[model samples]
Target: MTQPIFKDMLVLELASVLAGPSVGQFFAELGARVLKVENAATHGDVTRSWKLKAEPADTDTSAYFCAANWGKASLALNLTEPEQLQQLYTLVAQADVVIASYKPGDAERLQVNYEVLQCINPRLIYGHITGYGPDDARAGYDAVVQAESGFMYLNGDPGGEPLKMPVALMDILTAHQLKEGLLVALLQRERTGQGQLVQVSLLQAAVSALANQATNYLVAGQEPQRMGSEHPNIVPYGSVYTCRCGGKLVLAIGDDRQFRKLCAILGAESIAIDPKYKTNYERVQHRQELNQMLHQLIAQQDRGPLLQQLHAQHVPVGAVYTIPEVFAQPQARQLLLQHPGSKPGLRQVAFRLQGQQELDLSPPPTYDNYLS
Candidate 1:
């Protein structure tokens, strides 16, 4: 039997919504015993109410809440109550890590601040997630950070109204950063026997996620523009074209050879000979023209036959799959698990350690009895 990573480690999740809970969920997936603390006065996590159209309006369970709070026990407590605060203090004394998404000064007021918790348990790893920084009190909404951090500017079509990502990208990145920070803190405590404060903000995560786009602006003095399913650096990448069957196919032609092969497979070898489309750099420079040419060609043909040719030549082609189409896939089914009382098509935490992917499935807790 393979032992889980961070087995028996305790995580006190004082966070809510997506970011902090995401970190806790990752820890839980990694074998930590995570206890999610919700505010007794509120509707627990705000996401508990972020229901979709098909979900039961009367139920507290939600896709948004379930997405990040799996495999954790929930406890709702009022910080104002002395007995409840003492109960939390006892829990903190036993916990190895605490994750919080409180606004600027709220942590200190709630008495879950790092200084206080570390005093109670010197080995406690404290993590904080916020909108901008410790001094900024603004709430961290995904679209706001996406817009503020230049991420939105880099998304969507070049001339269309700048669009925010469909998913909570900034929060997701913040979770990854928090997870990394906590792991590092745990490692540091193992060596130095001292814990430290770790902080990550949505703005920081958004800016950092720019990757090469940030580099282009910072190092080369070039602002990134929206490309709309097109690659900024490579040509023919993200070039989606509709087929005769009304299905969409995307060609991911990275290098010159791949482009030449695609051209040959499409019986448009003249495209490969053209100076504007001969090399990767040339193709990038003439992306619009090249894509227009490929789009017309691919659009005229059926997706099935075109994809068969592309795959035979190994041109890295893929059919654009809708969400339902994605879930219907066999591989997607293998990645899914039967989580009770929530969504029917539940996905397992994405990790494949030693060819073993699924964890011991546990439903998210009902935080109902905690306040009572």
Candidate 2:
């Protein structure tokens, strides 16, 4: 079997919550040795306390905590204390990378900032995450960043109040950004033999991920509004319909051909031939009427047969799935990682290298195992 990459690398994770830890886990998944340094005074990472009602209150691990932290050892330290700070510095002297998410001045105050740590190990790559930027002191929260970054504004129903996403989307996006930056820094280190600071702010990451939505405004002067699940540029895309059996599915008919195929399958070939619905542009212009007609036709058939027919026609469609239904799929079940005593966790490293075998990783660590 091919060995996992980064097996000899060492990473020190000084971040809490999602973004930084998720990056650490990414490296850990690639076979790096990651040490998660949590706040001793706080009893460890903050997410350890973010448990659901069904979770045990006495434990330091939570479902939220397990979401990003995997394949790593835990170390709880009071960084404000001189001795504990020295311990971290000792580790930094031999570390390859350090992941941190402290607010602007907190790391400096604790003397664990990149400036100080880089002095101990000139070749150490330091990855930092911030709320705004290096100059901003405000703490970053995912929901608040989602609102500030225009995501909340573009979400939700047309006339309803703006809604935050179900997951910590900004944090996840920031984590991915930092991962890419750190990987580039690593590649650069191979040439220069020196490490540099890699930084990402939640605000910037969110805005950068705006993708085509940002272009719709900047290039086309279209200020995007909440259209629920609808796409601004595509008609019949993101339209949801319920079948006679009450199962719901979403459509993503991209081009005129797919739309025509959909119409043919629904026995609405006349609609496909109509001048107003002949092309994607015209269909987009008359989307309200087209969607209404499609919805009614779809609601007449059973979902299973309709999905099979659509799949055979190469039309992009997906059934709306609940959490349980999602996990029930073979693909989703294959990604699950089972630890001996803890709740099952999903793998964060979704991409596999060619010829790479399944990774042998440890479960997310508990404070009791490493708090000394």
Candidate 3:
């Protein structure tokens, strides 16, 4: 594959927080020259303060900030100022793409709305990330959107509190949605010699993420119920058993063969042969009974040997890990990164292009050392 797919493109980012910045960051990683513009007078992106606490090996940069803006250039200009606003317009004239996530009406106030900018740069691919609809002024943070879009109610245990995901999953989904739209826009621009608007919202992203659950409700009239770690339609597909050594492990058996094999290994072949627990649909219908019986059988086996046995059979299984444990894995170490002379660690690019990989982890801007 060619190196730096967006090598010659310039992206002007007028967004903050996760979704909008994430879109720009992805393009930057793919080789776009991204200039992150923040209002000089404000604190800038909200995520800069989203850090809980500084790590000991701190570069005085927020850990959250490093996750998205590692390799981008930064320039601060208060858009309210006439000269600075004109400078931004000039930048937009030169940029191949422009992205923003300001609340509804803020773009028009700042003179960076798609209608306004598209007139200046005919080929500029513009992306807008919003919390709700373009005109909705409600705050569109992930948890809030999760609650609004029926996503939160599908998480956690059935009888327990409806849970929100710890990470900004809605925002992440919206970012991916925006990225997909922009890529398509870029391709279309290549053909038509014109750019178009790409818009995504956290509310819409949450609805899109409903994936199977939405279909289940639409097709079968089955409202999704939270099953904790368990999959609603898949039987024996969660951490359902405690080993003899007292450690818990997930047992992700999909097909009938895997289920039969699992039952055979547990010395409970009768369960697999039973008409009520034979096929996936039947097993899902009787999951509670199946889990109870397997739980008892699984307790007879040692954790180490049980895991090894599952691995030998190629059944999907794993022990849950804490955050520190997750990063301690060998795969995690390979992706850890640090900027030159910076003392803290950050996550490197998620993957590499086929061509030359630029491992530049330039520390996120300090505001004082603004990018040219």
Order the candidate numbers by TM-score, best to worst.
2, 1, 3
For residues 1-372, could you state the per-residue lDDT of candidate 2 as single tens digits?
A: 678788789999999999999999899888899999989998899898899999988877789999988899998899889999999999999999999999999989999999999999999999999999999999999999999999999999999999999999999999999999999999999999999999999999999999999999999998999999988888899989999999999999899899889999999999989999898888879988988998899999999999999999999999999999999999999888887876788888888798777676788888877845
Global lDDT of each candidate: 0.85, 0.92, 0.82
Off by over 4 Å in 2: none
- The numbered model that scores best in lDDT is 2
Among the numbered candidates, top TM-score falls to: 2
- For candidate 2, the lDDT comes to 0.92
- Compute the lDDT for candidate 3: 0.82
TM-score of each: 0.95, 0.98, 0.93
Q: What is the lDDT of candidate 1?
A: 0.85
What is the lDDT for 139 in model 3?
Answer: 66
| Candidate 3 C-alpha error for residue 264, in Å | 2.3
Tens-digit per-residue lDDT, 1-372, candidate 3: 466777889999998877877777777666788888987887566666666654543343577777677667888898889998898889889999998887889899888899999999999999998999787987678888888898789888879999998888898899888888998999999899999999888899889989888999999899888889888879888746788888878888879999888887777889889999999999889888888888889889888888888788887888766778878898877776566676555442476667756545465776555665
Clashing pairs in 1: none
